[model samples]
Target: MILLRSGAFFPLIVMSLAFASLVLASLVTGAANVSFEDLLLDPEGSSLLLVSRLPRTLAALLAGASLAVAGVIMQMLVRNRFVEPATTGTGECAALGLLATTLLMQNSSILAKMAVSSVTAFAGSAVFLTLAHRLPPTQPLLVPLAGIIYGGVIGALTNFIAYEFDLLQYISVWMNGEFSGVMQGRYELLWASGVLAVGAYLYADRFTIAGFGKETATGLGLNYKSVVVLGLAIVSLITSFTVLTVGIVPFVGLVVPNIIRRFKGDNVRATLPLVALTGGCLVLASDLIGRLINHPYEIPASTVFGIVGTCVFLWLLYARPQRRV
Candidate 1:
């Protein structure tokens, strides 16, 4: 069965509870002294919650879930466990597009910027996939290595452009994933990425079939190229939305889906929700930890996750059982 089986019940409930608790913590965990009593008695407190806490929390959850799902799709399409949007130049290209929009059309709305970013991201992802296709399929590590190089080149170009135009600050903001600036009316665009994650789930079976390679997918009556394009579109849009909204959160996509797949296996339909939930939990918890660690000031969620995700990635690379091809 492609749907979640009975065996998934306990873990699903446990993760759901954990996600709920994190949501509660995120809703209350911020500066400016928000409390339950304030919510009932103080208009200012309620306004702060509406304007800041709620939106930031939602942004974290949405970005985490969508990015994680996008990672799963990328892994399946590319047939490699180590690759993700940040590695494949999707986020970098999105940032590039954002920089171009900011420099050229200073009055552009966020939607306009996001539209441009998505286009660039899609092109970048398509290029990465094309390069991956030409690599030696027998060497699984080559795909991600190539992706890292590709992303680095694009990132360098982005940095150079930002430097030339004195927009390094803008680039810095987009490259570091943080929620300190998130507020109502500013972060709602992430909901579309969440919707795209749902779209991924609806196409889960096809993606799973596509993971088996083009010949296999074609024999299975799946349009392999179309599936790849659809997956890339979802990944690009999610990457663009997250980059434009909360900056680039490294490894949420890479680490979460890989962790979930280790235990849940490669069945996309069965594991997608768990991956999404785990990713949301990881980001929300990181955000909460970032807030508490500094008290008044803040650490970027990306910085916090980069430390933790790096360790996890190394463990997955070395300490774990041998990887699948």
Candidate 2:
């Protein structure tokens, strides 16, 4: 118990230190260099600090936290830690929703696009769940594999539409995560993810129980179906908001939760804070590195995460024990 608690608590501390460093890095290092003294005294420096870097950092923090939490919830509900929104079709569905709305409405507002994308994402999740429930128990991996295939189908459809309508460039732009454009008015959409995160925290215990198996959860007097639906809804909402705000971030969700579990065990409630902290730190670090590495022309944060997370995921595939059914 002591060792477990120590390990769990240690990551939170490390993440906090990392987060602080990233924040300072964001403030100190940018396209235009403003000295500490100038940043402290100059009105224009202060405006840049408040208007630009601050919102970017907050967006990164919120996006990371939301994606990580959504990944945890999806893994628990599906009982597969390897599963995430990217793999399970939620991101693709949201992108498809955006594409459909763009094609149909031509010039819809971001808010309308978000609403359409969120609903489409939720519907995709519902289909996945329904199919999983109907699949034979002997083929346990079939469901998630099906989700991947389903996502591929949706992605192909999205591509077809984008190509046909000559909107491929627009699609590509929104498909990659970028923090560069985040400003004060634009970032309010991310607050939806924050609200969903709070909902996840409130229902954390039910999720933990649901992971034990539907029958067991039902035996415990929990409304298993409702809980599953609610969790999926929250996951869809977070994924949609994330895609809307900064585009699709691939594996922060998958990587962060597994890393947290290494130190914190598998208790959802106990691990939530660690997950949030690690996610925020990882995104912040990636954003800072992306900015500094290219100087004036910045790389997207998702690209950095993709490179790092892919290597980590490959290592985990070989190093970790297979999950028991």
Candidate 3:
């Protein structure tokens, strides 16, 4: 009951309501009826709800929370507000790893794909951060822009390789974040993202200090490098898990954490759950809106979120005027 008295309670209540509403809507909006009543009275609806609808809802929630927590860790690690797996070449690198595994082993297990992707993602993130610090740091936008370009190059290379191997169609299926294809057996891997989210909560204070940069962190008796590596590992695992389970969902990471940071002022532990809830809610809302707009045939959650995220990104970038030379 003390939770109800806490400052976080009201926001939690609002977010929980939103989350519940979205879950309910998603449960019922598919090709068949999956209402609560159907769960009790109709075996078919019960089966569908259990195997498909429930799993998809959980996937969205897990993916959203993982990515958002990852975004928070990343921004703190690099001290850059705008970087995310999609922008920072992490997703592209993971995709590249996926393609490589497909070509090399052809029938590799999902775990193999995840392992390769996580390795490549760690390397990619390392390169981005190294390059980011090497460049003149006059402009804050420099790092994100570079990361976007790098990710684009990686993406283009991935596409070329896919085209050569006649794997473009398969690659396309995994490039975008879409929940339409989610079913129980396929989505259980996303549970790893939930575990990673909890880990983020545990390391929240360390990341908070690391964001102050090496000198300050070292001064405070912290091993900055270890903290960053742990953070990167978390991000990599989260990214690879999502890609393997539901393809790459962009912007949930980039947008949700930034909004929370702006309003809550970077108290990650306190805001961690909020970031997770808001991110999941945003993706859930996107999925719901897509379901309603097209009815039986639905748009990908990625497409809807892409639009929403792009708008929020623009606002964050240019909402306030900047003085240029």
Q: What is the C-alpha local distance difference test score of each model?
A: 0.92, 0.85, 0.87
Task: State the lDDT of candidate 3 residue by residue for 134-243, as single tens digits.
Answer: 76757779889999999999999999999999999877877898998899899988898999999989989999999998999999999999998999999988998988
TM-scores for the candidates: 0.95, 0.92, 0.95
Which is better, 2 or 3, measured by lDDT? 3
Cα TM-score of candidate 2 = 0.92
Ten residues in sequence with the least summed lDDT for candidate 3? 316-325
Q: Residue 170 CA error for candidate 1 (Å)?
A: 0.6
Runs in model 1 with CA error above 4 Å?
Answer: 1-7, 322-325
For candidate 1, give the lDDT of residue 114.
Answer: 91
Q: For residues 108-184, could you state the per-residue lDDT of candidate 1 as single tens digits?
A: 99889999999999999999998998999899999999999999999999999999999999999999999999999
lDDT of 1 at 275: 95
- Which should have the higher TM-score, number 1 or number 2? 1
Candidate number of the best lDDT: 1
Q: Write the residue-wise lDDT of candidate 2 on 210-290 in tens digits.
A: 998899999999999999889989988888898888888889889999887865678899898778778878988888889
Q: How accurate locally is residue 222 in candidate 2, as Cα lDDT from 0 to 100?
A: 92
lDDT of 3: 0.87
What's model 1's TM-score?
0.95
Order of candidate numbers by TM-score, starting with the best: 1, 3, 2
